[model samples]
Target: MDEGPQFSLEDDGAGGNRLVLSGRYLVSTLGRTNQQLRAIDAPVSAVDLAGVTAIDTVGAWVASTLAQRHGAEITGAKERSLRLLEAVKIRESSGSVAPDRLPVWQRVPDHVGAMMRDLLRGMAGVVGFLGQIILAIGSVIRHPSRFRGRALVRQMELVGVSALPIVGLMSFLIGIVIAQQGAVQLAQFGAETLTVNLVGRITLRELGVLMTAIMVAGRSGSAFAAQIGTMKLTEEVDAMRTIGISPVEALVLPRILASVLMMPLLGAYAAVVAIIGGAVIGEVALGIPFLNFLERIKDVVPIHDLWVGMIKAPVFGLIIGLAGCYQGMQVEGDSEQVGKRTTQAVVSAIFMVIVIDAFFAVFFTEIGWS
Candidate 1:
């Protein structure tokens, strides 16, 4: 049943437009009206939305769009509608955007108050992260048996063994791509022999870790989100709490520990496979001999490059693990929410990896050679 006040319009015409509209919006009502509006082919001026008993975002959108197309004056658009209209008005006034289309600070809320709020939020997050880490460490200490040989073996397999195939494949492809691209540029200078150094250095410090992290984040992040979300939906988290088992300690800690421990090893493996792939390409395509490639690699790849890659590896792993866990925890009992959170986990993990990689690049540049 259509449940609200049915809207009708009254015209008060005296050389001016006066439109009165009243309606109670339901799905069927709005749908039919929206379709009617689309089919309309006449001047619709001075809309009176004041008669709307209860308006929602969709109704507002429809009304606004109608106003735009017909040059009609509309009233009673609310909240989001008001902001959207204001933005549209701004755009309309500036037909061609000026050089300073928006002020520098306008892009993001740059008022002092907003800046202070953002700064406070950032600091709070940092504090919370540190506190969590400390608490985790204390819990580990209380149960030092968790660091047993068997536990280590399990984690090694979980992190290192599982990550191999994907990392190997992606790294090999990346090596080939970098080599091929660099060869095109280097060939002009007749520097075909430099492919080894180019591939080695780039793979070791940048592509190897970055590519591996992205793959793991996509693979593992989704896994964590799905696993945790399903658990949450099934009330497994509540069960764990009832059993006095800290879910964080039981699940998250192991995964984090495993990743942190194995990322360096996986990264090293990626770099090696990538180099082999690049070496194969350089030898066959670039006519550089195997021994010459090895010699070039030895000359250019310092221990520092390997160290940088190894250092970033743990950070990358932590980024993937934390993002997944965070998004998973955000999931409600709703089944759709699980999928949504899983996607967020993968996205946030990848974005964080890229941002961290950029920071590492800057750091490496600043530090220079060992």
Candidate 2:
């Protein structure tokens, strides 16, 4: 008769991984059961399975269980050992388990709808802002004395002072680009000298003023929105009303009146810089004499073009200021909300300015005044 498979554990010394298992395993000869598993006494990197000979079904099950509980790094585990482990669902103790299924693609529509909802919320804020402007206008009309001269002047400075550098830079670069493009196309027709005409006419009539307004819309419009939105978020608007002060008189009025007054001046400033820039490019790239460039430019660009551009300035200022103030009133009392509305203010202001420019184009075209 053979003894059942089992083994006694060894004493693990210091500095080794030790494993202790109960019971003996494997039948070697009659009258004595052979050792099946040897207990690891030290830190073991591997277990020797060579000691395992003919394994009963229980022996296979024991091997598989040990492999799963510890590690299956046995040096002598052959196909039989692996097969037995597989049949019993034995796996490495450190093996990673992952989900059997992946998430569905239906999350896409939900994300898109969220984005659209945010856009609509921003638009509603703009509508509320327009209503506030009307209310402010009425209040201002009813109380003209409320217009503090010193504060109004400061407001004008806010709208105009910081705008000059950007206006000059953009207009100068735009003039250079126009001159370069004009020279290229005109050279094909042997009329490269006409770059003076192209630069002067385009800059004075449309580019200079439109570009100035757009810049202001981007810069000042966003400032207005962020400022107002932050105040709204902080409940400053409500505090003013509580103190018997009108937010319009205190905030919207000054900014709007400033924009209405100063953006035209700034536009005029931009136009002068643009013309000067065009003249510089006209002299170099187009090889046109400065004196001739100026003289010829006078004949090409009508003085009325300057007026047309200047007229668009106050309108742009209104759109920009209104958009900013409107967004401010819509602020949801968070930094993120303020930032979002500020961006909306800038985009809407720029969009409105472009729309107004289209109207100018039509008005000029219909009146037979290029």
Candidate 3:
């Protein structure tokens, strides 16, 4: 039979007190060992483990914890046991073990400061990315031979042609809703005819391009980020670089070009579809004829309203493309990071699109185009 662990305390003339441990220091012996330790009345200055016959991780933890609590020096440990003790000590000192908790008030400032620092760093990175994109575009303009026509066309098909059905359907429903609501309000004032003006101006000057941009940001922008981010994670982007190919030129410019070229056409299509939907609602519900709706739209909506909306489309597309590509480039070697960047790309693109639209609205208003 094996003997359990034991501890004894001795008075050392100059050393305050000494604790001696013997026998198998294992989990089965821990309770007795703890009881023996608790009975000690003297302040422990050192522990001698020379008599310890065998030990394991649980035993080491027990020994280390008692040593820490008593602020006692440990000695006479076997080489392997000493290494384990040292590792536990290192872990405790390094705060890898249980750490002290700070008050919530103290932690709040730390969290806020970290958040602010991250935000500043992110903004700086975006600015740097924008500069890089501009440099890439300038290089492409200087050397048109480097342009990838096939890639651009493929991206256009993905971003534009495939998007038409959803965009048309959403715009049509929105137009019908707007016309119905406007008719209700204008009827109260006996000015139901004004519903056509409301639908035409809102759809042509704002809603059409805004809705199209938002949808594209959610759909194409997230795809761009995920695709490029996966390529980054797989080292395909690095491979392109190694082969003397600019990732910006090969991957980014084609997408950006496709977006800018196709957005205006999509916006115009959305506007026409919405107007037709509104006309249907007006004819059926408000007793307004289709010809009368067309005449009213022509009279109320200026060509400049159409121009304003069209002009915003390319800028919105550019913002969406840049945001997606920038976030993708920022992705590290993590699948989780790819998903995070993809979501961030969509959010950032939509936000920037709205901001740009607001600026355009202000500019047009100041210039008397509104």
Candidate 4:
């Protein structure tokens, strides 16, 4: 039977100590020996390993550490044990465990440069993705048979029809808040009735479409990323390609088309619902007749305001759809990536929507749309 590792120290004839090790020095036998070794701090001039019947890398490391601490020479170690000891020594000398630190000024510039590089790469990727979508749209146009009408209809239901209740509820509450607040502010100026104009114009020109876009980005946009990301993870996208189907046309085009087509309608519906909500507040809180408020919307809110919202709606939808599908297609490696990409899609879509809305606001103001 193999014995557990044991160690002892004895004085050399020259008045120095020699540490002697015995028994099997394998990892399985080193538990008590390790504890015992940690407790010893005696000066030693040499380590003798001849009495060890079996040894491994762990044992070699322990012996090497003990010898180095006391500047002791190792003796009676076989060739295999010597090699392990040398390997551990070399690794300890190499600075692989910790990285070198840079000055704060250097690190700050490096971080900023990296961020800029990432931003440029992301912009290039988005441009390339847009080109792919354009090509896919053209292909569907050239070969009408490739168009998946049922898929488009289904996506439309998911992106638009199914979203109505929540969108309506949200827009209604926003409208009430806007009206109540506007009424109070205008009352200070003795122009309380102008709340009707405030609610109509703002909801039609900005809040209605912007809020709806945000909701859709949170809802359908995230869904698109998750669904396609899951499909990618499952290799379903690859299977479609192997069978001669363009994943872009079969998967992406329908979704984009559905969003582009449905957004104007949804935006218009949300605006109408918001106006109705404002009308409710007007009647109950401001003592304005509901019918008169509705009649006033037609006159107080310009036709151009509705046109501005309608114009932005499809663009917002396109942005949301593109962001979602692009992030989904970018998913790779593991299931964890699907969740991360889904979150990225929602964030990117809403960010781009707000950016584009700002640009449109400036452009329309310059062109006298305001």
Candidate 5:
């Protein structure tokens, strides 16, 4: 039968004692070894491991802890035992280490720097994505047979035909509100009749296309982002790429083309709806006859105004489609990212739509379209 692990102390004659260990040092003998170590009252000068015939990690931990607590040197350890003791010592030291704390003032600058880097990286991604879409467009132009007509028709129905009811209702309400407000203000100058001019010019030149674009951004734009992002999360996008299909051409181009083709029609329909709403409001509030209001619109609202809005509609559609699809392509990791990118797509598309409208307003004014 093997003897259990044991420990003893030796008086070194220099006012310090040496700890001596023997027997198999393992979990089975840990209690006995611990009791023996705790009974020693003298300050330990060193731990003598020469008599330790067998050992393991648990035993090494016990020896290392005692050596550290007493500030005693480890002595007489064989090469293998020495390595194990060193490992235990390192582990103990690492466990005792504390993380450095930063002051609030220092942390602010670090956070800001990280934000700036992230913003720059995001901008670069957008630019690269734009280039990819342009290349895909070029490829489609070169290979017209590769175009997906069914997908394009489906997207047109989604982006245009299905959205008509809400777009029409929204535009109608907006026009009524605009006419009411214009009537109230123009009545002060006995120019309540000019409300017809106000409604016609604004609806045909700006509000019709602008409002429709915003609606599409919120509806179709978010849908595109969520749909593509979900596909990405499920690795469907990756599968398309692996099978040698260009996701940009097959997935993105149809959406963009559909939006571009359908936007002018939607905007035209919205404009007519808004004019009808304005006419109703004018007849009820200002006692203006509907035929007289129609005559005023025909006489005052120019063809240029309608053309200006029509041109901006397709451009706004392109922006909405690109923004939605681009943000979708950026989705990574998980479902949370899909939701976040979808929100970003809607916000970015609306923002770009307004900014582009502002630029158009400025350009048209410079060229005397105003």
Candidate 6:
């Protein structure tokens, strides 16, 4: 039969009191022993558990608490009792309960501070990466033999030639939509003819380059990140370094060069294709001759509009390449990081491209390019 948990106070030879716990010290047997122990006002020098017949976590917690309250040494516990007491002590020390939530005012400022810190760190990383690229460029310039023309051509084909069909198709559809919408809005004013100007100026000055940049960022930027990140994961980059080859020159420069060189040609091609699509819409939907619509584009869309697109194209390309290559180079540890960095590359490139385009718009307007 189990006995109810009980305790007694005894005097030690040192004149301090000892706590002698006895019987089965379990939750069901504890009864009012918890209250009895809490009521004791005398200081305890030692918690003597030698008489404890059996103990559980709850019982251990009670004994642990008693010893802690009086700074008494726990004594004579069997291995199982000792283990239970230790586990309870560890749980208490590590906090078994959830922490209190911070107020909104404190949380908001704390979140903002953390965000700003992360932003600064990211900016520093980008700057350092840019510096490395600049140094690589200098090294390549000094040794022209180090330039990888074949890699540049391959990247050009992958980034530009392979993307042409989709880019053209998208631009064509966008052109038809723009012309149709512009014609509808202008019809109220009996100026449907101005649809030509709308499609021409918008596509050449903004939509052509902007949409192409976004597409390239999603396509080539993600590809760059994934490729380089995979290589990093496999230690191919490290192997290159071991062989005295600069990964930046052998990998990054070629991609960047190809993107920079191809973007203008692609943007111009997309704009022209879009113009053709608008012409088709004119001939089929608006009753204007296709050839007449094409002729009118040249008269209405100024050369400056084309110049704006061409100027933005290579800059957007550079941004995409840098974002992709930098993110890829930063990837470490696992394949999951490759996916994450690839996504970051695409998002960052697209965001930066849009921001730069906005700045370009303002600068061009101020300089009479608009």
| Model 4 TM-score relative to the real fold | 0.85
Ranking the candidates on TM-score from highest down gives 4, 6, 3, 5, 2, 1
The most accurate candidate by lDDT is 6
Count clashing residue pairs per candidate.
Answer: 3, 12, 0, 0, 0, 0
Segments of candidate 2 deviating more than 4 angstroms:
1-127
Candidate 3 C-alpha lDDT tens digits along 1-370: 6688977888867868888888898877787667767666678888889989888877777788777778888889999788778776634454456677899999999999999999999999989987888998899899999989999999999999999999999999989999999999999999999999999999998999999999999999999999999999999999999999999999998888888898999999999889988999999999999889988898988999999999999999899898888889999967999999999999989988988899999999999998
C-alpha lDDT of all candidate models, in order: 0.76, 0.73, 0.89, 0.93, 0.90, 0.94
Runs of candidate 1 exceeding 4 Å displacement: 1-130, 146-155
- Best of the two (2, 3) by lDDT: 3
In model 5, the runs with Cα more than 4 Å from the true position are 1-111
Task: State the lDDT at 171 in candidate 1.
Answer: 87
TM agreement with the true structure for every prediction: 0.65, 0.67, 0.76, 0.85, 0.72, 0.77
Residue 203 lDDT in candidate 1? 90
Task: Report the lDDT tens digits of candidate 4 across residue range 290-340.
Answer: 999999999998899999999999999999999999999999999999999
91 in model 3: Cα distance from truth in Å?
A: 16
Clash pairs for candidate 5: none
Residue range 1-370, candidate 6, lDDT tens digits: 8688878999998989999999999888787889999999998999999999999999999999999889899999999998998899933356558788899999999999999999999999999999989999999999999999999999999999999999999999989999998899999999989999999999998999999999999999999999999999999999999999999999999999888988999899889988888899999999879999999998998999999999999999999999999999999988999999999999999999999999999999999987
Alpha carbon lDDT of residue 38, candidate 4?
73
Model 1 lDDT, residue 221, Cα: 74
Candidate 1 structure quality by residue, lDDT tens digits, 148-248: 45655675686679879888988888888888889999999998777777899989888888888888888877887788888888899889989877776
User: Candidate 5's residue-wise lDDT over 322-342, tens digit each?
Assistant: 989999988999899999999
How large is the C-alpha RMSD of every model relative to the true structure? 9.8, 12.6, 6.7, 3.3, 7.3, 8.4
